[model samples]
Target: MGILSRASYVIRSKVNAVLNRSEDPTETLDYSYEQLRDELQDVKQGIADLTTQKKRLQIQKRRLEENVEKHNDQARQAVEQDRDDLARQALEKKKQKMSQIEELEGQISQLQRQQDQLVEQKDELQRQIEQFRTKKETMKARHEAAKASARVNEAMTGAGDEMEDVSRAIERAEERTEDMEARAQAMDELRENGALENQLDDRSSLEKELDAVQQDGEVDAELDTLKSEMGKEEEPTANGGDEAAETELEQELEDDTVSDVEVDDSEVEAELDELKDEE
Candidate 1:
């Protein structure tokens, strides 16, 4: 993906992850109350509608009964006026009205039954909504208390341990200080014995001496010539220059070149031997 798209995706993913981890019992309670309220409203509306339907059926039945009475009066008037045909027609109209009234009564009875059922349903739904409200409140309280307890536990277990960390840091600092003091005392003893600095200086002096000796290789060769000449029965050719070089090399080798350092194991042993002889 492009950088912008990837960035957007990561941001959205993190936001969703955080939201998913968070819990909102109050919101859930509110949502449940809203849903129950809606259902309760529907139930009430249904009861009202059924009641209205029952009333309309009653009005229609009343109107049909009034029409039948009016038809009976007309039939009686036609018989009194010596008009049998007119009376029969009025009587027939009255019969038709009676049939219609019967049909309307049946519809009214059915509508009354429906209205009763709606009333019962509305009452039950109201009770359910009330129960739901009580449960939602309980759950909200429990969730709040649980969250408070978790915060308290975190403070006690996590933040409280900082005091212990400070104490441990002080202990470590004291240990380091004691170690440094011991090391300083040891270094002071080494300085009093003139061993610490002299040990480093002597090594450098020895290396310089070895370098000079290697450079005067001809002097060493002449020393071998002198020894060989002195051992032979006859005298060998000797030069003044060679004699001077050998003499200078020997004098330089004999000079005290080592630094004033503590002696080695063999020197200490030789000193102890001399002390024993003196005793």
Candidate 2:
């Protein structure tokens, strides 16, 4: 083919493909049904027109028949009155009327035949349209059911855009939830490890250490106060025993001092001589 012819063919094929894709069977069927109805209406109109023409012809034929009868009566009268020329003229006019009536009858017959054919065609077309309507409705119902089933299948298989979007949303939500959970767990771990204390607390590390030392000091001071309080509580119970032991020690010391004084002089002289000899 020439380039122009090939281009035209390609264009036509593309247009046909587009039309096929865009065409709905239900819509096509409805359009065809409407076209049939319009054709039927046209056929009926034609039949009506044909019938009208036939009626006009019939009326004209009736008038011609009446004229023929009037001419025949006039011819008889003319013969009774001895007017042969007038009779001949009247007869000639009657013959022309008869010829016109015959022609009108033929035309009427032809119109009747056309009307009859059109009526039959109209009836057949109507019947076909009715049958097509029934089939179209049945096919449309089946198509709708199939379309709904296909949509459901696409949703179930996550093949549809909306279903795919939902799947993606769920995945995103899961990812976000997992990330949040991981972040929360990490925060908990950091808190447990005391690594987040500086971030969470308003204190510097040095300040925190100072606070800890202060707390320890306060605890030690409180411990010392408790020890002092306990010792004070026990001191009253031990004071009487301490005073009795002190009196017993003082009595023993006085008795030993009196005995030492009684032996000192004699013992001193004798001890000095014994000490010198032993040396």
Candidate 3:
């Protein structure tokens, strides 16, 4: 083919492809149905016209028959009155009318045949159109059902464009959530290791150190108070009334001192463990 012909062919192919993509089967079927109905209407109109022509021909033939009967009467009267020329003229006119009637009958017969053929064709075309309409509706219903099923499948499988977009969005959200969790865990680790300080705290480093020293001094004072209370509870109240009692009191004081030392050490260890946990 020539370049122009090839170009035309390509254009036509592209147009057809576009049309196919854009065409709705339901709408196309309806359009075809309408076309068939319009054709049926045309055929009915044609039959009606043919019938009207036949009726006109029949009416003319009836008038010609009436004229022939009138001519016969006139010819009979003329013979009775001995007027043969008038009778002969009337007979000639009647013959002409009869000939015209025969022609009209032939035309009417032709019109009747055409009308009958057209009516038959119209009936056949209408039957085909009805069948097509039924098939078209069934096909349309199937097409609609298929479309609905396809949409449901696409949604379930996440295959459609909107579903894909939603899937991506969910993935992005999950990634962001994981990242935030990781960052929070890292921050907690840093805070626990004293690598990161609380931004909300207003105290300077020197002030914090001073506060720590003050807290330690308070703990030491509380420990001293506790030790004095224990010492008072363990002290013997006996006067130096007997040597045995005095010796026993000394022994008890020594044992109490050893127990107090052990308790003090335990209390100190517990305090240290608490401080470590807080840090």
- Could you give candidate 2's per-residue lDDT for residues 15-51 as a string of tens digits? 9999999999989888988998899899989988898
Q: Cα miss at 2, model 2 (Å)?
A: 5.8
Per-residue lDDT for 47 in model 3?
91
**Candidate number with greatest TM-score:** 2
Q: Top lDDT: which candidate number?
A: 3
Sort by lDDT, best first.
3, 2, 1
Assess candidate 1 and give its TM-score to the true structure: 0.50
Clashes of 3: 0
Error of 3 at 190 (Å): 3.2
- Local distance difference test values of all predictions, in order: 0.84, 0.89, 0.91
Q: What is the TM-score of each candidate against the true structure?
A: 0.50, 0.73, 0.66
- Candidate 1 lDDT, tens digit per residue, 146-211? 979977886676654665687688999999999999999999999999666765455676787798
Clashing pairs in 1: none
Q: Worst ten-residue run, lDDT, model 2?
A: 229-238
Evaluated at residue 231, the lDDT of candidate 2 is 68
Whole-model alpha-carbon lDDT for candidate 3: 0.91
In candidate 1, stretches whose alpha carbon ends up further than 4 angstroms from where it belongs are 1-23, 159-279
